[model samples]
Target: IMLVSVTERTREIGIRLAIGALEREVLLQFLIEAMVLSSFGGLVGIALATAASLALAHAMQLPYLFNLQINLVAFFFSAALGVIFGYFPARRAARLNPIEALRHE
Candidate 1:
């Protein structure tokens, strides 16, 4: 996903670099995009899991417990995974030569 993003936005990155955007800034932009995407997915997953668990517990006449710690851990883990996975592509985007990227067809 990150690679696709970087590849798709090569021209944008080149324009940004051409316009004097710093490498770290470009890197940060991609990193933030990845984290947001992962975090949103994680939140949706947690919501679905919670709803399903609640439905099952009610059907079984059992207590439904929402484990905050587990949810937090999962969310953070997903965000961390995004950062780890995104770093490579972000680094690559940041390192792109403005002329070469702009000339990409």
Candidate 2:
């Protein structure tokens, strides 16, 4: 998805680069986008798991407990993975030749 986005936004990236946006700034922009996407997915996953566990507990007549620490860790882990996975594409975008990118269609 990130790759596709980078491909689709080549012209925009070119414009930024042409306008003197730093490569690091482009990298940061994509990385932040990745982080936000992963974070949202993580939150949805956490919510679904919590709901399922609660349902199971109710069915078994057990007390449902909230595990904040584990959930936080899971969320952070996902965010970390996002940044790791996004780095390559972000770097690719950052390293794009502005003139060539601007000619992309």
Candidate 3:
């Protein structure tokens, strides 16, 4: 996904690098984008799970258990995974030759 994003934005990345944007800055930008995407997905997943869990619990006459700590941990884990997985593509983008990227259609 990250790679595809990088590929899609090749011209933008090229322009940024050409305009003297630091490689680290470009890398961080991609990483932050990935984190945001993952966090949003995680939040949605949590909400859906909670709703289903609640419905099932109610049907079974059981108490719905909501654990904040567990949710927080899962959220953080997902964000971390995003960063870890995104690093490679971010690095690739950062290392791109400005001239080559700019030539990309």
Task: Find the candidate with the highest TM-score and give its number.
Answer: 3
Tell me the tens digit of each residue's lDDT in model 2 across 1-54: 789889999999999999999999999999999999998989999999999999
Better of 1 and 3 by lDDT: 1
Candidate 2, superposed: residue stretches over 4 Å from native: none
Query: lDDT of each model, Cα atoms only?
Result: 0.96, 0.96, 0.95
Output candidate 2 Cα RMSD: 0.7
Alpha carbon lDDT at 69, candidate 3: 96
Residue-level lDDT of model 1, residues 49-69, one tens digit each, is: 999999999999999999999
Off by over 4 Å in 3: none
- Note each model's CA RMSD in angstroms: 0.7, 0.7, 0.6
TM-score of each: 0.97, 0.97, 0.98
Model 1 Cα displacement at 93 (Å)? 0.3
1-105 per-residue lDDT for model 3 (tens digits): 999999999999999999999999999999999999998888998899899999999999999999999999889988998999999999999999999999999
lDDT of 1 at 84: 93
